[model samples]
Target: MLVALIALITTVLYFVGGALLMQRLKLTAAGEPPGSRGLPRLFTLWGAAIVLHAFVLYAFLFGENADSLGVFTVVSLTAWVIAAFLFAWSFRHPIHVLGIVLLPFAGVTVALDMALSGVGPATPMDPSLRAHTLLALIAFSLFTIAAIQAAVLAIQTHMLQNHRPGGLIRALPPLSLMDTLLFHIIGWGFIFLTAALATGLFVLEDIFAQHLLQKVVFALIAWVMFAVLLFGRFQFGWRGRKAAHWTLAGFVWLFIAYIGSRMILARLLGV
Candidate 1:
């Protein structure tokens, strides 16, 4: 019951933060400066939400009868990290508008985690395994953010190409700025992903017997995609739609590698 209450409060805070961000975006579209009044309040609210979210995670992970390392729990953790990173980044960048999507998503994840009360793995995670999992989740979260940024960049590109850059597009940072941010996100995600893969090698004893072959293959493919994209960006100056497409493609493969594989194992194979 206490957990439920905390989750509810966290959800409300997230939605409220999202609403505030949307309003800020609207004001920007209306010619108001992006750093106008009320930003500090929004930041305060978001910080409070993140704190409550951490409490919720603590309750689930450390409370009596706690053993929840399930999919939803992993996802909730990812959301929390993303929110925390974005909260810090927003102070220096025009990226708070991303909260319009991220905040609501975080709220929903919190609610789902509370309602579902996910179960933990059958066996306990060893230290190396835990380290690998943490790195992998961080990588996944960063890539998720990059994918969302790429989607927004696509919209900005479309609007610009059609000469209809008004509304939400007007509230976004300049195209070059957005492009640079997207690649930066991808670069960091790629680094974490590489580290995750390296750690995974130490954790896995037999990939084929453990049914991790597909996951590893898919992850490697994603790594290659991002590597190629980054190489192209520096070697050939790739940006705009091409970069967006590559970012999305890499995210898809990574999604399949982790989340999709888990779902299949749990639901279909009953593993």
Candidate 2:
């Protein structure tokens, strides 16, 4: 009961934060700087909500008799990590443009986690497996941020290219900064993903034999796509729309590799 209450409160805060961001963006015209006055209070609310959410999640995931890690738990944890990172990074970087979309999505995931609970089998808490899982979650969180950055970059590019920069573009970081952030995010995500894959292949060798071959294959593909993007960024000076498109494309493969494959194996195939 307490857990549900916390989740509900967190969900409300996330939605409210997202709505506030959207309104703030809407209020800023194409040529005007984004409003910053309301951000401190908003960040405080998010910090409080995330702290509660993290506490609830830690209790649920590591409680007595919590031997199995379920799909819903994984999804919830992934979103939680992303939200936590976003909140922390907001202090150093002006990446709040992502909150307009990410916060509401986080709210939805929290609600779903509370409502549906877990539908799939839970994996036992093996130490090596836990390490692998942590790496995977961290990698996914980084990639998720990169994906959001890519999306915003795409929008910013289009608005500038078409000279239709009256709404969102005004509120976004400059294009060069957005592009730089995207690559840096992708670079870090790639490193984490590489570690995740290494751990999966070496520590969790049985996963491939146990119906996760598709996930591994797609993950490799996503890794390769990111590699190419990074190489192009450094070697060929890729930027603007091209970089955005490739970043999104790499994210697509990753989405398929992780979440899509999980949905198939657990929900559809019932394996």
- Pick the TM-score winner: 2
Span of ten consecutive residues with least summed lDDT in model 1: 117-126
Candidate 2: segments with Cα more than 4 A from true spot:
30-34
Clashing pairs in 2: none
- Report lDDT (CA) for all predictions: 0.87, 0.84
Q: What would the TM-scores of all predictions be?
A: 0.94, 0.95
lDDT of 1 at 3: 78
Which digits, one per residue and each the tens of the lDDT, describe model 2 over residues 1-271?
Answer: 8889989999999899898887778778634554678898789878887887787678668876377787777888888889888888888888886888888888888888778666775667788888988988899899999988888888889889998876777777788888888888889899999999998877755765677888899999999999999999999999988888888888898988878888788877787
For candidate 1, what is the lDDT? 0.87
Q: Candidate 2: lDDT of 6?
A: 89
